[model samples]
Target: MTIETDRLRDLVAAELGRARDRTTLLTESVDEGDLIRQHSPLMSPLVWDLAHVGNQEELWLVRDVGGREPVRRDIDELYDAFKHPRRDRPQLPLLGPGEARRYVATVRDKALDVLSRSRLDGTPLVDQGFAFGMIVQHEQQHDETMLATHQLRTGAPVLEAPPPPAPAVPVTGEALIPAGPFTMGTSTEPWALDNERPAHQVIVPAFHIDRALVTNGQYAAFIDDGGYDDPRWWSEAGWAHRQSAGLVAPQHWSRDGDGWASTSFGRTQRIVADEPVVHVCFHEAAAYAAWAGKRLPTEAEWEKAARLDPATGRSRRFPWGDDPPAAEHANLGQRHLRPAPAGAYPMGVSPWGVHQLIGDVWEWTSTDFHGYPGFAPFPYREYSEVFFGPEYKVLRGGSFGTDRSACRGTFRNWDYPIRRQIFSGFRCARDA
Candidate 1:
């Protein structure tokens, strides 16, 4: 193998090893049987998740690559996510702690050896990229599951840690962006999800997309104005959503008159008026937009406004010219696990003046979540396939808890209007 290939292989191997190490360390905090019992229904058992992740890697990277099937044929039948019977995973020989960890260690060693000598050049790297991607994702997911599992097992939230002192707010002014035919979606790059395919032209007439997400104080204004009680501020769907859930405000918002408080790291702290409102739902955002005489941007318009390149109409992994999100810029998971003041990342701005497009909070758009033309499922059968119609609307950008890689330009996410749990919220755009 070439030096570049060798180096890449080694790096990939190391990444997997790091996941192994993290999971190992996390296990020390709780008893294994108790962990499995607590989070069983919400998360797969540790042994099951571990074996399945590795078995999936081998199946996709080896057997599907026009290479020989695994020495154990049943491994695919046993561990493949597509193959595994959903919502019925507990009956299997889910691994115990020591055994499950050992299984992960063994399969990883085998995968490294196979990859080091495999001849998969010119073959689509989707299997290779997504396999490694999902494995890392799965392990990291396991870490979260274990934590939540511990809570489910223990009946209390585990991440009850407090945040450090707040950074003083910056005084800033409105940024004006003159809009035009801003082309939307990915115009460059080969690897992207099905929702981002058929990279086509979109015409966005001039409009004012907010320079930042709606802030705590701004949302408070809506609440103070009786936005919920007034019918003029809500669509039929939005009104029904509000009435069904008995939701009157953003999930973490609290006001005691003299001051405000917002939830952070699973605890409440003094509210910063300028902080963008995170942890809201599509329904809540729609109502707020209606009240403001603005509407959510179409997914096309949101993508166009958020796109960074002029020459290629390329998608960006982040806004502000694709330098991965930084602490000073956005309030992503790596940060306080909470909202950040909007406009925190000036250099991270898009081609237009849209801020917080990458992280901070996922912004809900008016567009319904649907697949592009000629879309097909890859490894996971029901990923983008299940929600490919108008039943759900599109959401752009990402939230504080979002996986950074999952927020790439052209990436699409959808949820029923009622799912306010994912830390999603929105900004509005006025028709020009």
Candidate 2:
């Protein structure tokens, strides 16, 4: 094997290990009761996620890539996510906490062995280690989901992380992205999901987008001005959901004297004025944009702001550049429990001076989930093809809980428009 091949293998192995560390942290933070319990109808039991990741790794790496025999063929059906829904997972026969831990550990041991000898440049699946990258991303994505379950679980705070750094510079207002064409997707990103493939040109007219995300204090103004109660500020569907759900503020927020407080991971704290507001659904974000005399950027517009480099007339791999994320770049990889104050991570800003565009929150966009112009599902259709429709809205960037292995400039995330349980927020944009 060449030196380059050795380095690539080492990098892939390190990423896999990083994802497992996070998964362990999320699953081991609580007792067996917490792991077995389904905290919300919207999420699966922690144990389900714990075992599902291992099942996927076994299917993709141990069996498919390495040509090894099945580790636990019987449990494949039990962990098939589409075969069972989140609300019904707790009722199904699932591995206990200890059993799940042992199962995943065994799978990881075998997977690492496969990595030690597998060719890194043969078929497309093995070339550049795409299959291994996919498995690492799958596990990290589930780690994020498990973290959300912890938030919904009823108990004392079981997670801990240091606060994000204070803002390094005062940030306010918006930045103008000059009207032009920029690449919107990636044909070259080895691990990019199918939906973000077939890099294509997107022409966006001149627009103004918030330099920073909508802060808690900014969102509070919308609530104060009857943003939720006024149907005029909401879409027909948003207003209907607002009424039916009886939403008065962003999820986890409550009235506190003349201010507001929010509970996170079982700990309640006074709302910080400059911190980005989170736990908001797409409807809430759109309505808030309307109330502010702006609108949520279309998916194209959001991508232009995040990836386009004005000087070079090209799109980079991240807001900052093609380099992988670092601690000083964005608040990702569950390194922090909450978003940093606006204006933090000056080094993370896009070429257009858009702050916090790549992390802290999954910024909602106006576009529905869809395939790129020349999209084709690589290995399976269930990953992206099944979800391409109006039923799911596109969310760009990532969030504090997102892992770097699963995120990039072209990465796309989608969910029901009414979902607020996930770590989500938005920045308003306007035509210039």
Candidate 3:
């Protein structure tokens, strides 16, 4: 094989291993009981995620790419995400924690073997090692999900990470993005998912966005101002859902005497005013924006702030540059359980001076989820196509729990507007 092919194989192997390591850490940190138990109706049992990642690896890499026999054909239906919802996953005959670990390990061994021998330049799935990249990203996505499960589990904190560093430079106020058209999607991001395809141009009016994310202290003021009780600050649907859900503060937060505290990963601590507020649904973000006389940015505006460099008139792969994410760039890959202070990653700021745009929180956007113009689904429709519509809202920027493998400037994540269990937050935008 050529040197380039050898390098591709090694890179693919490393990423696959990286993703699996995180999966192992998330599952093995707790006992078998925690592995099988569903912490909430919103997420699957940890073991289900474990074995499901393996099943996907086997189907895509070992069987489809390598043309090998099925590893466990009968169990495919058991791990099918659409067939079995999170609420019902606990009752499924899932592989035990140990069994799931062994299954994934075995699959990884064979998948690597296939990668060592397979050509990386043929077929759409294998081209540029997209299938391998997809599998790596798939596992990392589940790792993030498993990390969320860890956060939801009731017990002493079984997982730990030192706090993210304090802000390097003082970041306050807003940054202005001039009005113009910039590339909105990607045709060049080799591993980009189908939704962020067919690079498109979006013309955005001039706007100013928060230099940093809204912090806990800022959100606290909203709550104190009766942001929830007032319907005028919320949309009709948002107000209805707010009343039904009995909305108070962000999830896991409670009034601590005259102050406020939050429970995270089974430990209760006082809320840090500087940390970007998380666990907030889209409705809460929108309400907070409305109260502040602003609005959640449309996805295009958010992208322009993150990717466009006015001097070069080129869109970058990340806020910092084309280089992959680094520890200093943003809080990612579960490195720290929570986000750093709002202006923490100065080195990671965009050319437009937007801080922490690539991580910290999945910033909510005002735009409803939809396919870009000239979009086409590749591999499968289930990944991005089926979910397209007004019912789901788009979220940009990966959060603290998001992995670099699955996140980019063009990456898109969507969920129900009312769902808050996932790591989410927002920065307000206003017309220039």
Which consecutive 10 residues in model 2 have the weakest lDDT in total?
147-156
lDDT of 1: 0.63
Q: Model 1 — TM-score against the truth?
A: 0.79
Q: Tell me which residue pairs clash in candidate 3.
A: none
Per-residue alpha-carbon lDDT of candidate 3 for residues 145-240, written as tens digits (9 for 90 to 100)? 888888889987899898899889998999999999999889988899899998988899999999999999999999998888999999999999
- For residues 1-432, what per-residue lDDT tens digits would candidate 1 score against the true structure? 577666656766776676666566546555656535535454555556656655665665555532654645555566655655535666765556676566566666677666666653455443344455555555654554443334334332334333322434343433333455544455343345556666666566666677678888888888888998887878787788788878888775677676567655345577778777866788788888888777777787677767646656555555666665666555554344456676566656776667777776778888887766556565565657877777887887766555454456677778777766556778888866
What is the lDDT for 401 in model 3?
Answer: 95
Q: Write the per-residue lDDT of candidate 2 for residues 181-254, one digit (tens) a residue.
A: 99999989988878899999988899999999999999998899878878999999999999999999999998
Candidate 3 error regions (>4 Å)? none
Give model 3 RMSD, 1 decimal.
0.8
What is the lDDT of every predicted structure here?
0.63, 0.93, 0.93
TM-score of each: 0.79, 0.99, 0.99
Q: Model 2: clashing residue pairs? A: none
